[model samples]
Target: MCSTVVTPTDRVQPDVALPFGGWSAIVRDMSEEQSTSEPTRAFREARDFLLAHREDYETAYRDFDWPRFDRFNWACDWFDALAVEQPGVAALTIVEEDGEVNSLTYAEMAERSRQVAGWLTGAGLQPGDRVLIVLGNTIPLWEVMLACIRAGAVMIPATTLLTDADLADRITRGGVRAVVTSSSEAPRYEGIADHCIRVGIGGPVDGWLDYEDSRGYDGPVPEVDTAAHDSLLLYFTSGTTSQPKLVEHTQVSYPVGHLSTMYWIGLQPGDVHLNVSSPGWAKHSWSNVFAPWNAGATVFLCNYTRFDAEKMLQVLATYGVTTFCAPPTVWRMLIQADLSAVEIQIRECISAGEPLNPEVIEQVRNAWDVTIRDGYGQTETTAQIGNPPGQPVKLGSMGRPLPGYSIALVDPTTDEVGDDGEICIELAPPPVPLMRGYRDAKELTEESMRGGFYHTGDVASRDEEGYITYVGRSDDVFKASDYRISPFELESVLIEHPAVAEAAVVPSPDPVRLAVPKAYVVLAAGREPSRELAGEILQFCRDHLAPYKRIRRIEFAELPKTISGKIRRVELRADEAAKVDGGERTEHSYDEADFKQA
Candidate 1:
């Protein structure tokens, strides 16, 4: 086992963790020195096993064990340990719009983080204090995250895109004691609670302290000890249907738990990884922070105010990004560009945030000769299922369960395990990556963690080979003509049409069939919303989908989405329900019957 296992960046131990106080006291008594901690050796052994068998999924799955340790800190343990051995290695790199590139070596990052941790300690931040970090993909972001982890403080990562209202909600619910954001965003924090400490990046502010000052703090700070189960981060989920849930993760849960995510992305030591996600969300941490770092890979970021696929490709080519992860929305836009015009250095490409549409995957393979593997995870857990490297990717399948995850499909009606049903995880051996629970919502958390399983609230179908196909969200799946319907199945087929840019399928009410598939589509830039175009799209779906799955109603309008860029099918479902007289044609809507009569 390597020295990165149980080591932390800090050299001193605190009396207790913030808010929750001292779970660390016991951990402290058990082991004062982590260099020889038994649990740390176990964790290193587990991590090395996955990396050793990155492509051999069957052997890795059969052997991987979730490392259990009472005292663990990723910053000092894994990252700084690597710095000691490979100090000059690149840890993080960012490319600006005007071609200004900034990078930090592993040693530089570790020491800089220690400086920030020392500064934060001077600011009276103690263990367990919730620090809400709101910054762009700046170097300070990484510094602050490591500082918080080293201090045994709970870090709440927020995107700069979050509104002032979102910050208020998080502060109230998350009990934030400190906030770090840019000076331009400082005005948003006006009249916030006086208890919250504000640290501004870039320039300075009247009442805010400049983040640049952290570099001046050359003082030493002791390593803060936190238990494996102590709260480390509180993530506010991007709500697609209901209000956002405050998902909590302990120290090991995310830092150590992302071993699966590391395996899923097929990250290797010294690989340059570029993950397309803004700060604040779970996926950003998944690929950008934990997964890549777990494998000793360098994280690359291309900062852009506005997305340009061609420009991004140029950056990817320049940076020699070995591994890449992007959301399906970004993938769809990339397919729109002339992929052949640009060169890409990315060897492994993965898609998440939403299921990968097969058409998008195929187009990229045709253009780049690399398959875009799909992965499935959420704010609640690390990468649980993914099409890992070297595996034959079955189109539309999100691969088999990654090591450390025990997946089961349970029929909601029967509550019995089967080939298809609600996707759940076995709790007998609860996966290490799974979140503790939704903060302050015991009822909701219990409901989600019932039956000795963690219910994912999504549905999927499993094959004999253990490959699972995402059906749809549990609520989004409906019955049409006495047959079960998966919106994803219909939507995937609909996007294959050349005229469709993006598509969302919902159950449209019908008198005869009780309900029928209706597609709410956004047309490609050059296409018109005429009945003629609608006929071609419906015909395309009819030829590919089952008879019952055929889209009977078409609405060529902009699809509604949440702030986080998820297609809000619930809103579309409600709009269809609002229609009177059973069903009637609306603006830009074309029924299949009208097109057939043509």
Candidate 2:
């Protein structure tokens, strides 16, 4: 049976004698200072500013000031300040492919980044010029990121897994002026323009600047004026539903907006936070760069080429990772592994990127004796809704809105506030962490920002207690025989089966009905793709779901996905329409007629 918490009718009153603690204690300890009589004034100032202006858009936008600094560097001003006092504190730790370990201290990283920034300046890298950072989870990757941050240069982060075509698209679209990558991957950029300087990290490549020499620079850190509104990073959206759009972020948006993330993750000073996310994705910056560091927590990394669940568990035990965040895919894999044998010291386990299935949540809670909190957000924003530490977590609901966020469920057709519809922000000119419109797409931005609200394009339903439940993407949802169908709801149920590894549900074209639900599934290890297995899954869904939401068809194959890991339901929907036009049907499908009693 699912361990689902029913929604409450009103705000939960805090009890005085709660065992673990309330949110206040978490926030206070997270922002506490070291070796000083006063609290961390800088953090407190920033947090107080945000709290004072919470939900007040005009005052927050107009008066909530950015940190004043004519000669300010986040690495130097913030990180260096901490490093000088705590030189031995671990800043970054990574596990290598050869079973060796590498770690960098706060002071060492600060000095290294300063040297790299000086070297890049000498190499003719100027402020405002875009640099494409394509590297894996290595020490140099973090160094380069901090160096870029210190240099006041806009960074276009690309994953090492990107192909030549993908690189070409980013280079052309992002207007990159330089490139930094490992020497082993230098061959991919052989024919690119000479204007784009190549800085190889590992070793000297032909005609490329060697990053190793950057360590020899003995000059003091270069000083520059970095305004808060200045663009710090440019991210390309993962093109799951459409073409990738360049998303721009300012110095303050991520740096300040992640206050909510720090609170959501329950990060505290002296805590070690481990997040499983590849470089180039926004989530990497969310957990690895901004959130944990904002809370003064140590950012930990466990690098692996291919995922090994057992090895990951051992690392958590060995490293004493205090807080952890991973996507649902990783969490699902962990449930299938022998979790009882692994001892995890994790205080909190959180899931984002997609909604967490109730079954997966229960399995982990049973094994680890900790609740896995569910969070909601997008590539364009910070954590909007989440079960913060000490808050009640309702199963299948993406918790309440975070402290600063105000969510309204508006009926798209009626343009009125309702219990279920498009999730939107009612305040005109939405809050921080929201993208400053899609880069170079004015029409698209205006369309999304219409009706005096920022539309999420995703649908959700809210209960009387304000707990929001994710429905489905507006485009992916459809009606079959006058009944609305949510693909995510059905897909969530399908993944509960032990035979299923991943599943994507879409509407299959039908003659009598407008459409019917069809599931595309990836089988787990040791499971075969067969009609018998497909029939078993179909039967399981039919037994669990309501009659209107039953899975009528099944296909055993790899689900189509974007370059990023998101499943592409749009592609599946189009393919199903084409197949129906061609008079094709899967042999394993079952209709209501197939289950009739004579």
Candidate 3:
């Protein structure tokens, strides 16, 4: 809550005490028209090194160094520098479904964000004020995000798909002081507290400030003296297992930490990068905002009401997209279409959000001759592990650790480093990409950082070659018949079956075996749910999986998913347990015993 704004003539001495329990080297008072600042220079050097060695993974990983600076605002230091240097470069491009394309240059975006910052500041937006953003993939989302960075306000991004209860929970838990959402979404906040500073986009709403009003304000905004560790973004996780914890990021964590993500995606200057992700999630900020911009790549978006795989493919080909990133679900849907029909210019393709199945990867590679590299990380950190460009990608592996991240897979119970265990990032040296900590949850944060490492709840195994293959979440991986079972491994094989569109594997209660693997599956398009189809799918798993890890039950039904598109296996597990207690079974549920009796 420290407002360390200083004027051009006010030069404070080093190690100024901040009220927020941090020490700043200096209270920076920078002019917009000034030449390249020290922070800008240092950041550019790190970014340029990655771009220079984009294809050379070993050299980049070994020789690269994170940019170290005391005072840095990515919007002010890096993005604004790019605007001054390459004013006419396309920074963002949004292609609407109706053939409308809107593109903004670096200078234009910088100026707009500056105007927004000035307007928000004039309206009494103070430093450390948390603003909840519930907008979509429009131009204003980027503007407001950058403006908040410029104005020194913390951002809490929420998805428009959130329900009223979800909104209330976020508003209360996030301690949101302001909200910027679309005019249509403004009414959704009617039941929430009315004390928040609400701004509506696209149109006017009663009692809400109009976002369009910022266009008239072109005055100078106050300079923000943001320290490296100041809170910038507060993300609400998908909560696949439990309630979503507020993941806090500092000025350096995501804005600068995404240098690793930039490297993972293999983005370069002037490259058109298309990332299929909805707003409000971490990956959206990862690929759509920071990573592409960090590499000076054009952030491209194909805005469509509904996803059309052919149209998405055509858009990539038409726009000459050089690098593309999408979730595993999108990849699965894209491969279902005729990929060979559209010849895309995408040089790099990556998948995140969840582990990409090898079947989906193979299909895309076979059709487009471009391998889809899988990467690993959570909302708590940036891309910690990934298959960078020019690396030998191992099938079904998320690949090696990126630069600036020291990964250690440790046994959960023993906390011993090993080849197969829970994925943990070393805390010694504190990688710049890691989050500040979980906000308002000291115990949870302490637990995560307990054993000299930031423990990722997900588990994985490392090969002798150092490549990492994702296992299931630590809670999701259960034991059946005295054998450990990875739900991801089982689900991956389940999806390989042609009829299964999506699947979630969880343990079902059993009196004899303690528990057995049960798969809840969603059928592919034109596929119907039937006993014969379930038998065939189970047979597919039986053939592909080991006897111990075989899926014992199959239910042809929609799998529960978080709004971020992650399968909620915890819910599925609870449902199975409840059913066992009640002596109930779902209508579409089929068991291996039925086939055995037949």
Q: For candidate 1, what is the TM-score? A: 0.92
Please give, for residues 1-598, the per-residue lDDT of candidate 3 as tens digits.
1112111121111221122121111123335434477888788888888888888888888998888778989898888767655565678888899987777776677777877888998887899999999989998999999999998999999899998999999999999889999998887889694979899999999998899888877566756989998999999987755798999999999999999999999988778889988899998999999998887777889999989888998998887888899888788888778899987778999999889888888888999888999998888899999999998999889999998888999998898999989999998888989998999999999999997999998899999999999998888889999899988899889988999878889999899889999999988888998989989998999899988999999888877776666777888899999998999988899999889632
Over 1-598, each residue of candidate 1 has an lDDT whose tens digit, in order, gives 4423232221111221121122232234334355444555666688889988999999999988898888888876766666655555677888888887777766677777777898898988999999999888988899899989998899999888787788899888889999998888888888784678889887989887788888677566648877889999999988766778999999999999999999999988778889998888888889989988888778889999899888887877766777888888788888888888877777899998778899999999999999999989888999889899999999999999999999999999899999999989899978899999999999999999999899999999999999999998989999999998998888899999888879999998888898999999988767888878888888888899878778898998888875456788998998898773456568788888886542
Residue by residue across 1-598, what tens digits does model 2's lDDT show? 1111121122112112211232233224433243221223454466555444444434543454334332334654566555555555667777775766676766566667777888898888888889999988888888988888888888898888887988888888888888999999998987663569789988898899999888667655564557766777889887755678888877656766787777678776666788998898888888998887665567788878788888888888877888899888788788778888977788988888778888888988899988898888777778787777766778899877775567888887998988999988755546766777777889988888887887888899998877899998889889998899988899889988999878898998888779989888888878987656766788889789998999887888787765445677899999889988998767544444454320
Worst 10 residues of 3 by lDDT: 1-10
When 1 and 3 are scored with lDDT, the better candidate is 3
Q: Where in model 2 is the C-alpha error above 4 Å?
A: 1-42, 47-73, 585-598
Candidate 3 deviant stretches above 4 angstroms: 1-33, 191-193, 596-598
Off by over 4 Å in 1: 1-40, 579-586
The C-alpha local distance difference test score for the whole of candidate 1 amounts to 0.84
Looking at candidate 3, what is the lDDT of residue 210?
95
lDDT of each: 0.84, 0.75, 0.85
Question: Backbone clashes in each candidate structure, one number apiece?
Answer: 12, 0, 0
